[model samples]
Structures are given as structure tokens and as C-alpha cells.
Target: MAQAPPMNVLEISAHFRVEHDKNRRQFSIRLNGSHDKAVLLYDYVGKKTVDLQHTEVPEAYRGQEIAKHLAKAAMDFVVEEDLKAHLTCWYIQKFVKENPHPHYLERILH
Candidate 1:
């Protein structure tokens, strides 16, 4: 049997799709080559002020900047819905701290 070739960043990034499972209160991305691979995971607080509770990227997906995409998606959703946000997730907190976009910063719960 032949092994599949490893995906390059552009190839992998092109296939990336983030989905919000509102029922589960999570935002996630499925990896392209592995069924068991969860590229990113983010859970949130669903109250008046949505608190981003946790974020995880499987070890295999780390260093690929996948978490950044997840953070942006979650923050964009919060902004679009006109909801406040609390960055309780350390990864998200760090991402926001580093990127500091005005739109995301404005909605943050200080």
C-alpha cells in the first residue's frame, strides 16, 4: 500500500473550513487528511457576553497557525452578532494580545 503525500500549507489551508456547532457550543475545523484529526477546537460561553472558554489544536496541527484561523472565526462571529466577548481561552487571549485588531478589541470584556 502506498502512503498519501503530506499536505503543504497552501493545500491544507485551502481545504480548511470552520463550522460552528451551536448545539455543542463549539467552533471546529476538520483536518484534510485525517478523519480523527481535529484542526482546532473552541468552546464559548453562550450568555449575553460570550466568553471564549477553551481552544485546542491537536499536536499534529500545531505550528500551522490553525488556531489563529479559529480565533478569527469565533471573534468574527461575535462581532457580526453584536455580542460581547471574554477571552478566557489562553490561546485566544494570546492571539488577541498579539494581533490586537480594533474590531475584536472593542468587543472584548475587560
Candidate 2:
């Protein structure tokens, strides 16, 4: 499906923080209640690749475009760092498939 451009529900705030959540088994995106919100999780898998391995939304958080928000944050990071990503995570793969503008495509895919 042609998903709308992902928004950044995960925002930057004065208290912005990204830390591991042992309970969720992933990094937690959080803020101190500014215009920021936590909407996704990810971590590094290798030197050049980040594993956006498990992306989820609490049931109540569903359909608010939270996953898309996460995609935006992740991809923006990839682009900012001038990095090539390996999307081992299925949801991330799906995100790329749904938002193909060539900018996000890995070299191998071309």
C-alpha cells in the first residue's frame, strides 16, 4: 500500500532520551512531555547497519501513524550519518517498499 509519508511522532525535547528497555527488549524513545513523544525502538546490529528489528505500537497507539513516525526518525538518522542501511527488520523492509523514492534504497538493491 502507498502509505502516507511517515511523520515524526518521536520528537526532540529538552529531556530527549534513548535508552534500552529491558522489559521491551528494545530501546525506548522518550521525552519529558514537551512536543515530543516515544513512538519507536531500534538499535545497532553492525558497524554500518542498524537493526530496526522489532517495531511496535501499543494497541491504543495504533493507527496514529506511529510506525511511520518511527520510520521517519530511523531513516532520517541513516541519511544524516551518510550511512547505508541493511533492513533485516521486516517492518523496515516493508517501510522501504512502501516509500521508494530511491533515497532510502541500499546499493545492492539498485
Best by TM-score: 1
User: How many clashing pairs in candidate 2?
Assistant: 0
Question: 1-110 in candidate 2: lDDT tens per residue?
Answer: 87554333334333344443433434345434444444445555556655566676666556655566566667766776666666656767778888875767752122
- TM-scores for candidates 1 onward, in order: 0.77, 0.58
Q: Candidate 2, after superposition: displacement of residue 38 in Å?
A: 4.9
lDDT score of model 2?
Answer: 0.56
Candidate 1: stretches off by over 4 Å:
1-13, 37-47
**Deviation from native of the Cα of residue 67 in model 1, angstroms:** 0.7
lDDT of 1 by residue, 2-101 (tens): 8654332222257676767665667777776567444334345565678787778888778888788878788887888898988878888898889899
Query: Candidate 1, 94: how far from true, in Å?
Result: 1.2
RMSD of 2: 10.7
Error of 2 at 70 (Å): 0.7
